[model samples]
Target: MNYFKQILRFAKPYRIYAILNIISNIFYALFGTLAMVSLFPMLNVLFGKTDKVKIKPEWNGLLKVREYSEAYLNYYVTQKADQGNDDVLIFMVALVISMFFLKNIFSYLAMYFITFLRNGVLKDIRNELYKKTVDLPLSFFSEKRKGDTIARISTDVLEIQHSFLSILELIVREPLMILFTICAMLLISVKLTVFVFIFIPISGFLISLIGKRLKKHSDKVQKEQGFFLSIVEETLGGLKVIKGFNAEKIFNRKFKESTSRFYNYSNTLLNRQNLASPTSEFLGITVIAILLWYGGQMVLVEKSLDPGLFIVYMGLAYNILTPAKAISKASYGVKRGNAAAERVLEILNTSSPLQDKPDAQEKRDFNTDITLENISFKYEDEYVLDDFSLRVPKGSAIALVGQSGSGKSTIANLVTRFYDVNKGSIKIDNTDIRDLTKESLRGLMGLVTQDSILFNDSIKNNLLIGDEHATEEEIIDALKVANAWEFVKDLPKGIETNIGDSGNKLSGGQKQRLSIARAVLKNPPIMILDEATSALDTESERLVQSALENMMKNRTSIVIAHRLSTIQNSDLIVVMQKGKIIEKGRHEELIAKNGAYQRLVTLQSFD
Candidate 1:
């Protein structure tokens, strides 16, 4: 119920729809009860029990209002009976039909207005969930599955719609329908109504016992659904590897296992949910059976109740059963909804560790050098970069040459502020990167990673990500600078051609060149190339290296180099081993020293 209340806040914007639905449901409940109560007059007319009164009944005070209303209705019917019994019967039938007609019309109106409120909340919740997912830190996703996030946005939200949204209708319509029906029953006979109340608590207690563990089972089913979805996501992503290794059966078996558990959990959850309707119906029938016996004694033995009115009382009692069944079903739905809301709120309530300070200033341009002073950082407990420091002067290419796990990429991540340092500060000019808005700080730098990340969009559209307002001439110029225009011009649609998923339609070197072209279009003051040419063949690497050299011409660049031959002309080459710098000098000076950088050069030359 707490989780359900949290989700209800999303309904605030659609409160007008909710208010309209409530008004409609109120009328629907009023007319629905009146439709059944109208049976009392029709039964009296059918039984030839119409009263004959020549004089009008006087108005009574509120305490005797029910008796006065009956006296007035009897006098009115007696006047109508002067036409004929057949005409009076027709009139009574017309009254019942009109009551039912109005009831159904308002019922339709209630559903119509509720549709807007329900779907509006659904849309707003999904939109907010997506925005939160995007705003969360990259580190937050490290321990979570992508498909699990997808499940929260897709299936869990739908579950909330089906379950929690139904509560809105049930809250106003069902209870009011029951309340009106019960009031009419009390007007007929208070003793029988009180007798009906005793059994209601017993039945409600029994029905609630079935749903106590419903949320627990529902949570398992939702989690298993997320698990199987992850397996499918993983299989699609690694389809080529699976085929190359001939491990199709491994993934197939894993998928089947996940689905098998989902099957079991769903069966348990649905069977419990299915039990609610029938159990409530049987309990309601049992109550109805008891009422018939007790009310029969009042009419037959005590002579305290009228037969025609008892018949109307039975119809009103039957009306209560439908709404009672609905309420019981909705109770089960609420339990199921609680599980989904918890999963959804878990994402929405998560506060990102990388929030910008309220007073943080925007730093739009790079002036002096970028500085990392005594920075100690860790992904987990052990420090990946301990007391690491570096300075990059404007318009100079500083190359980092290191073994695989030597923190070269860590330095790149820190400079970009993807993760903040544990013990030190990274600054642009003199302002700490943390004190600058992340967007403005990132705006000054361009990143090209080991993998060429592009979307399944046109070459032009992918480049537009760098600068949305870039002109066609600027795009062509940027492409020419990155050496990508040569191949792009030869394509079927040139820059407008669609690149397949992650730009898989293009070759490795072509993709890297497009990446470089994107960076060139942005034309940031600082460019960080992390092993940009390492994944290409010899000919491809040569072309990409030329593009890299051209792009880094006057930009302040940090190059995390893999093939040492490419960085020979760099202004400064820093050699690192196990997160610490071992050598720093020009390519010629490092070669003269015969140190670690020279050893790395020798090793690459041997390769």
Candidate 2:
């Protein structure tokens, strides 16, 4: 119930729809009772028990509304039949028909109104989850699989919508119907109704006991599903590697094990959930058998109840079982939904590590040098940077050159605030980046990694993400500056061509150039290139580096260079070893020093 209350907060904006759904449910319950009550007069007509009492009689009490409505209906039918157009039996039949019609009509309205609230809440919840996922720190993603996140967003959230919300409707509406039906049954025969109460509680206790295990099994099923999805995502992302290593059988075994466990958990959950229907039905029939024996004597042997009245009481008694069964099924559904809801809320409830402070200010521009003052960072147990310090003037290109794990890329990430430093400060123009709004700080820098992260979207749309309001001419000019215009112009649709996922449709060099083009279009004051040309061939590297240098001409740039030649003309080159800078100077000075920088340059010269 507490979880449902938390979920209902998403419905606040659509409260009007929720109110309308409740109102319609009220009418739906009324119609359900009225439709059952309508059977009484028809049974009377069939048994030749029509009354000649005052038809439109008024009343005052709890039953007054029911009595008045019955009287008004009786009078209208009798008045019409007095003209010899129809018999009293026909009028009673018409009342029964109208009751059923209103019953279904109100039911439809209730469902329609609830749809608006359910779907609106679904949209809002997903939107908020997406925003939270994007807002969370990069370190959070580093610890979790992307596919598991995808499973939470797509499959798990939708399951909650289907399972939880559907049960919520039944929880609210069906119980009211059951209550109204039981009350009417009591009016007919309190003795028989009291008998029903005994068995219902016993059945409910059994059903609840069975359902206690459902949430546990459901959680296992969902967890396994996430594991399988993670495997699929990994396999697809690294299909080339899998094929190269001939590891298909190994991955297949892993996937099969995960799915097999999922299958067992699903079976456990479904078997328990499926028990609700048959268990409730068996209990209901047992109660009815008892009533048939006891109430039969009341009708025939003792003359305690009329046959027609007994028949209507049986109908009302049966009505209670329908809603009771629905409730049992809904209870199982709620348990299943709880598992998925917990997963979804796990993501939604997680607080972002990098969130704007209440007093955070938006930085308008960078007017001075960028400084890393004795900055230190660690990823979990491994320290990547230890007391690292560097300074870049307002518009200077500083290239970092070192071995793979020398913390070159970490510097770029730290400067962009992708991951917060463990110690010391990163200041832009003397203003600590932490004090500025994340959006404002990020807006000032453009980043291009080795992967050239591009989406499966048209080239124009990709460029538009850099500056959504950029004119067509500006997009084309940016592409030209990145040396991507030649290939794009040769394509069938030019900038409108769709680049496949991660730009797999483009060559390695083409993807990097397009990436550079996007950064050029952004036109940020600071550019971070982390091994931007590392993945390309010699010809492509030359073209990409040319465009990169063009873009970095006046911008404050941080380059993590893999090919030594790219940073030869760089203003400063910092050589890192372990978690500290081992050398720092121009390329010529590093060669003169003949240290780690000199060894790296000599190695690249041979390659």
Candidate 3:
């Protein structure tokens, strides 16, 4: 119920539609009661128990509205009988038939109005969930599964729609009908209505006690749902690896375990939730049976009740049970939905770790050096960089050469602010990056990593992501500079040819080159190339290095290279080991000095 109140805020924007639905529900409930009450006249006429009526019937104000209604109905029947229609029983049957028709007509209208509110809320909720997902920081995904997130957005949210909307009739319309019917019953006989009131709360309490564990079980079921979805996503995404490793049996066992857990948890949740409907219904029938035994005695033996009026009261009492059972089922649904709502709200309420600073402004251009001032970083508990410092003067080239784990990539990540440093500052020009807007800081630089990052799009569209306004000529020229235009031109669709996922349609070197073309198209003042030519055949490496050299010209470049040959002609080379720089100089200078850089060069030369 608390979660429902929370969800209602989303309905605020569509209050007009909700109000319209409420109005229709009033009419729907009113007509529904009239339909049931209309059946009383049919029973009275059929059983030959209708009372003789007199004209000029009395009205005792609103307190006797029911008496006034009955008197008006008697007048209409007499008038019809006098007009030579003379079929009193037929007129009563027509009245009963009309009420049923009106009930169904207004019921449709009520549902139609509610549909607008229901779907409107659905669209708004999904849109908000998706927007929050995109705005969330990358760090938040570290401990989350993509499939589980997908499930939350798609399946779990849809479940909420079903649980909430399907029971909306019970919440608003049916309850109103029950209330009006109960009032009518009290008007007929307060004593029987008192019994009805006592029966309701006792049944509700007993039913709710049985459903006490519903939310706990539902939460467990939802969690297992996420776990099983994760396993399915993992299995499909890694099918190639699984087959290559011949671990099909192992994966099958793991999947079976996940589903087995899911099966048990779901059974528990369903079992508990299912009990609410039948248990409430049974209690309702028990009360009705007792009421029948008591009311029948009053009607037949005591002769204190009219047959027509007693029939209507019985109909109203039966109507109350329908709503009571529905509400009981809805209560269990709300509990289950609460667990789902919490899962969804968990995402909606998460604050992004990376956010625009209050004073953020877009920088139009880069005019000075990019500086790393004693930057140190640790991802979680493991320190990857310690007191590392470097400066790339504007329009100058500096390359990093080091063993693995020497923080070369860390430096690149820091310069781009993919992560903020734990200690010290990285500055673009003279302004500390922390003081600059994140978008403005990253906008000035372009990056090309060892693995090419490409989407499943045409080659032209992929390049155009760097500069959406780039012309075809600009794209072709960038591709030419990247040494990718030759292969692209030979394709049937040329730049329009699709690259498939992560550029899987292309060779590794070709994909890397397309990535270079994208960076070239961006034409940022600073470029970071992290081992750009490391994963290539000799011929491919030669072509890509040529493209790299061309792209590096006149730009502030930071290159992290594993192959000594790639950085031999670099403007400056720094050798690093164990999170610290051990040597720094020109390639020749470092070789002549016979230090760490010299050792690296000699070791790679033999290979």
The 0-to-1 C-alpha lDDT of every candidate, in the order given, reads: 0.93, 0.86, 0.83
- The numbered model that scores best in TM-score is 1
Model 3 CA deviation exceeding 4 Å by range: 48-54, 84-90, 165-169
Tens digit of lDDT per residue, candidate 3, span 40-78?
766765675544465668778998887787777667665
Q: Top model by lDDT, which number?
A: 1
Q: Per-residue lDDT of 29-62 in model 2, one digit per residue for the tens? A: 8788878888887776566565544447767776
lDDT of 1 by residue, 313-402 (tens): 999999999999999999999999999999999999998878899999988888899888999889998888888888999999999999
Worst 10 residues of 1 by lDDT: 45-54
Residue-pair clashes per candidate: 0, 0, 0
Whole-structure CA lDDT of model 2: 0.86
- TM for candidate 3 is 0.93
Give lDDT: candidate 3, residue 432. Answer: 84
